[model samples]
Target: MEGIVGYGAYIPRNRIKVEEIAKVWGADAPSYKRGLMLEEKSVPSPDQDTITMSVEAAKNALKRCLINPKDIGAVYIGSESHPYAVKPSGTVLAEALGATPEVHTADFEFACKAGTEGMYVALNLVKTGDIKYGLAVGADTSQGAPGDALEYSAAAGAAAFIFGRENIIANALESYSYMTDTPDFWRREYQYYPQHGGRFTGDPAYFKHVMGAAKGIMDKAGMKPSDFNYVTFHQPNGKFPFRVGKMLGFEKKQIEAGWLVNKLGNTYSGSSPLGLTAILDVSKPGDMILIVSYGSGAGSDAFIFEVTKRIEKVRDLAPKTRDLLDNNRRYLEYGEYAKFRQKIKKAS
Candidate 1:
């Protein structure tokens, strides 16, 4: 069966807390924290961007599988923050991993769903035996207007997965996607920051599509919430996942393993994919995992993965997601964060 041969995640070391951002905007820090259920968000350095993070993440995935980079048949990267408007991010990523020349590569974008969108395509390519291995990456240097509601939680990170028929760790059982032209969020070309529908992004957009896909997959598999050992939802904030999980009959414990939003904030395309990496790090054989990712253009992608015995053998081959998230961290004030995120204008 086509399944995950290896997987890895990368989160920047620099972080900025919600209080720091709220202070800068003269908003009530406690209210922002309580309302968003967010503490701090990861911040990319002056040097890091979508391409650099994707390279680091793909390198970690390669370490886990110990696969020859030259043999990788395809590379797909999904992000809203790709450095070049005209160039493909996958070409740079493939060259960095030495997977260039004779490899298929493309960049994808669909708001937050871009990452899994790439994963969906990569998996299909591998499953059809058109490629020996395919690399799928979801990464972002997510942006929010300074002092806007989005500033408190938009963060940076990347997750990469390798798929193949042999040496599987998590077997791909079933997958489903749901979409609508709701336009709850968007960024037009030449726009520096994304505009959202505010409260309009809630019921008609996020909840509806997420629930539709999650229920669709479970129904297709003839499974229930209790049938899965772990479940991860797109963590736009710390609140929505828990709220949605409760509504779906998933217990807190089932969702806790992948619930890193309070500390990591929203990594956009990296949200649910990063959560799944954390789950895979600790999951045991025969454990069932369900992951549903929501993208703000009003869509969701859901997948069912069954852990195999191979998981244990390859679990320690790369850095664990939680370890990268919690250890050796640097906390930044709003000033430094703005500089790093290039929110400040420099005199020419």
Candidate 2:
């Protein structure tokens, strides 16, 4: 009976179009549109950080679940871009959530996949009856080098899920994880942005880990690509997932069902979960959804979910990703984007 009680997502109100970035740097402007398959990327305001984003996502999720904050026995935040270097962001989130003193809370970091890793931990706790309900959040404000290709695509967003035994909306059927010492992408403690091995990240890192975990889940679950009604992957860029799907015998139709990257860019920790939220919006009862997440250093986690009758009833509580994208937005200039990203500093 342990399953997802509710889910929510938070996308910022501002965006930066790839075309604008392209136009600003000249005709070729890094080929952001062609290379990353991103049209616009979400940009959080100065006041909004990982903590604020997670709180918003968690609040929406709690509203959908209709559970009192006191009932939440545990809260976990997964992020690499925490607002404070020393304080546990989860503690700040728990206070914002108004959870009781009995709550157990902590933060988690595993590169970009940390959020999904939090979900996995929350699921296990709920399944064991150690907690009646738990909240797992994934959020990030990722950065890239000033002129690096990742600059345009790195974005911000957050997703939250409440796990419990009652009122299950989607049941986790099976999960598989693949880990390796692949250093396709990484940033050191003092580094401002991540370093990538370029083509190597695609061939042996992202593709290899994602495919291994995905195939492992499919093999264990006895399901095929056709069995899933929707499939979502951690989108570093628009082309990687599409190309990986092709290699695995899945067509564009299956991959495009999410189309998250084209609109939202790579949200780092929020990427796959945001894609899953997109799937849930259009998914029907009994539909199957498969999710895969990848992080540099590198590793992949794959999950299989089956929607239930309760999903229809709970659908109205959260605004879908499409609604979020269409309804709210502010535009920023390249210089403003640079400032927000801390690529440039203002005079004191």
Candidate 3:
């Protein structure tokens, strides 16, 4: 079974508190703080974007594995915020990682679940023996309208996973997906920010698909919530994963290790994968983990993995998700954030 050989995550150092964004919009800070349970989210620098972050994360993933760059047969970059519409982000990432000239590359977009989608393809490719290894990344400089609810949560981050059979770290066990054309969230061509149905994103879209996938995988694997050591869900906000976990019979303590949304905000495609990286960083051999991701176009992907002894040897090879989540953070004021995110209008 081809499984995870190495995994790495990159979270931007800059942060903007929910209060800061709330204040800018003349909304009640306490409301969002209490409701979303989010303190701050990540922000990218002017020079940083999806491609750059993906490259950084790929480098980090490579550091944890023994495979030479040229041996990588595929690289898939999944993001809603790919820098250019026409150019393929995977090619740029492959070139930067020295995996180009002999790689199958594609950029995937399925809202937030795009990363896991890439992971599914990469894993299957390796599973079929067509590729020795594959690099799948979920990275995004997530965006929101100036005063939209998403502004308080959309943030930047990236997670890269190296999939191969050799020296497996977290052995992949089972996978499943649930999807529908719910149209709960979308951004059209030339539209800067996405439009989402407010309460609609919750009950019918995110929750429905997330629950379906979780139950589907557990049933297929003949496992229960208590069967796993840790469970991670797409964290669009700090509260969703916890709420969904409880609803799905997972205890808070069982899910807390991967609950990074409060600290780093929602990394869109990077959200669940980033949380999984954090879990792998601290998990011991034989630990079982269940990860599920939700993308608002209305879908979820679930995977069950068992951590291997190899994790102990390579977990420290690159920066752990916690260290990145906790260290070198610089808070951004509304004005500075406006400039950094290019939200300010320039006088001609």
Which one wins on lDDT?
Answer: 1
Candidate 2 accuracy as TM-score: 0.96
Q: What is the lDDT of residue 41 in candidate 3?
A: 93
lDDT of 1 at 24: 83
**Model 3 per-residue lDDT at 27:** 98
- Report the lDDT tens digits of candidate 3 across residue range 124-173: 89999999999999999998889999999999999999999899999999
For model 3, the stretches where C-alpha displacement exceeds 4 angstroms are none
Residues 201-300 of candidate 1: C-alpha lDDT, one tens digit per residue: 9999999999999999999999999999999999999999999999999999999999999999999999999999999999999999999999988799
lDDT value, residue 299 of candidate 3:
96
Measured against the true structure, the TM-scores of the candidates, in listed sequence, are 0.99, 0.96, 0.99
Instruction: List the candidates ranked by lDDT, beginning with the highest.
Output: 1, 3, 2
Q: Write the per-residue lDDT of candidate 2 for residues 33-125, one digit (tens) a residue.
A: 776677888888888899999999998898788998998998999888987778899998899989958899989887888888888888889
lDDT of 3 at 348: 79
CA displacement after TM-score superposition, residue 257 of candidate 3 (Å): 0.5
